[model samples]
Target: MYQNLDLFQTSGAMARHAGSRQAVVAQNIANADTPGFRALQVPSFSEAVKNSGVGAMKMTRSNHLHGDTKAAVVARVIESAAEPAPNGNSVSIEDEMLHSVEVTREHSRALAIYRHGLTVIRATLGR
Candidate 1:
């Protein structure tokens, strides 16, 4: 029933985006010492959610390659801007930690919004 509601979809997308970012940050931190390892990052939650509505392309002709529009909507991994150390490793522990904190906050905020919206709906229905 909630699928019809845009609020639920937005909150869910935000949560997914945050989780993806957190995972990328964690991986970067884990590989900080690996030589030639480059840090990676994903787009912000708002940006991912903003472009989530694009529909999948229709296969009008056999020459057209199939594509999943939904997959494209998710965050894209990009190289981080952190300066590389002498070993050519670009992962910075301090920066990754800060990014992790931001991801946590975004996840929590999205969850809170979802819960509060449900509460308001329940109150309206006197449930």
Candidate 2:
């Protein structure tokens, strides 16, 4: 049980990030018709995964891939709301919805992985 704690913690973090991403996406969609509003986007999430650094799983890549550093992942998602908006509104509902769905799915997947790990641990303990 204690050994599986890390996985749970990591998954919780990822889920929190996904929830944050969803809120940003929702904001973008809500502001789509508002004047002077620019769409907000979530930063690179795969980079976040790499930075989690659980290090239990390794990627099988032929050429070495420059793994993302933890600092890069920790950086806050800054809103670049300076895009030129002809109608004073830069948000796009369709795009925001699509991105939100994708992020939510990823969060669910991560939770599933965490649950599976816990199940395995429980089985090993004969619980």
RMSD of 2: 6.6
Per-candidate TM vs. native?
0.81, 0.70
Q: What is the C-alpha lDDT profile of model 2 across 26-114, one tens digit per residue?
A: 88877887888767766646666575553534334646465432321342466645454688787766667778789879789878978
- lDDT by candidate, in order shown: 0.83, 0.68
lDDT at 74, model 1: 78
Candidate with top TM-score is 1
lDDT of model number 2? 0.68
